[model samples]
Target: MEIQKTPLKDCFILKPDVFRDDRGLFYETYNQKVFEKITGLKIDFVQDNQSVSSKGVLRGLHFQNGEMVQAKLVRVVKGKVLDIVVDIRKDSETFGRSFSIILDDVEHLQLFVPKGFAHGFITLSEQSIFSYKCDNYYDKASECGIIYNDATLALDWHLPKEEFIISAKDLELPSFEEAIS
Candidate 1:
């Protein structure tokens, strides 16, 4: 697999080596030993979550706080999305910095989103099947988020604001500044 580092301290874009033949294609999505050898991080993903969203569906800029914080290996299973992550680690040099990438079935790319970051995605195809492996189990009381359209962050969703179909909860999330405050 090819591991590409993002500007964010511990974020990465991983591309697995694909083997194709006349009948099908195969790749190792995750191998604990190889993953640890290459990334130098030992991750034990306890939960595997998948979601199906229609075009324009914007999920979040969300994270879990304290001991509930999660590190995720996210990818697209059937379509495409604009995946975004922000470093929210207060003491880190890259805190408040954001990164974006296109995750789609075609390229089979995956993003490694570490803890201390807010992550979100917008469906870019007619529908998208997004999946992720999380290192920690979720805790509702520890759930936190920043509004996707926070002016301070000024992230480009690659679509018009009117086209985004966000949940009322996400729409009401606090701004970046408010979230860190």
Candidate 2:
């Protein structure tokens, strides 16, 4: 596995070594020892989650606060997506800044989104299978998210704003300023 750092602190892009044969292809998505050695992140993911969405579907900008915080390792399995992450830690040097990357089935790349950040993705293919591993079990009371299109951030999702299909639940999320404050 190769660990690539992003501008946001504690975030990374993990590329795995793939072996292709006449039968098929194979790669190790996560190796505990190697993960700790390369990223210096001592974490044990307790729950695995998957979401399937169609083109233009936007799911997040979501995170858990305080004691329910979660760190996620995410990847795309069946299609393509533009994954975005924003640092929301009040004390983080890169607070409020965002990072974006293309995660696709072909490349088999993964993103490590540590606690103190909000994460979201937009599908660029006909359909996408997005999966993630979370270090902490979810807590309803602590769940929260900032609006995906927070004006302060001005994120360029590479898709037309008019084409977006967001949930009413997500549309009502607070702005980044409201989240941090």
Pairs that collide in candidate 1 are none
Determine which window of 10 residues in candidate 1 has minimal summed lDDT: 30-39
Which stretches of model 1 miss by more than 4 angstroms? none
In the range 1-181, model 2's lDDT, one tens digit per residue, is: 8989999999999999989999989999988898899888898999999999999999889999998999999999899999999999989999989999999999999999999999999999999999999999999899899898899999888889887989999999999999888
Candidate 1 lDDT, tens digit per residue, 94-136? Answer: 9999999999998999999998999999999999999999999
lDDT of each: 0.94, 0.93
Whole-model lDDT, model 2: 0.93
Off by over 4 Å in 2: none
TM-score of each: 0.98, 0.98
Supply every candidate's count of residue pairs whose N, Cα or C atoms clash at under 3 angstroms: 0, 0
The ten-residue window of minimal lDDT in model 2 covers 156-165
- Measure candidate 2: CA RMSD: 0.8
C-alpha lDDT of residue 168 in model 2: 99
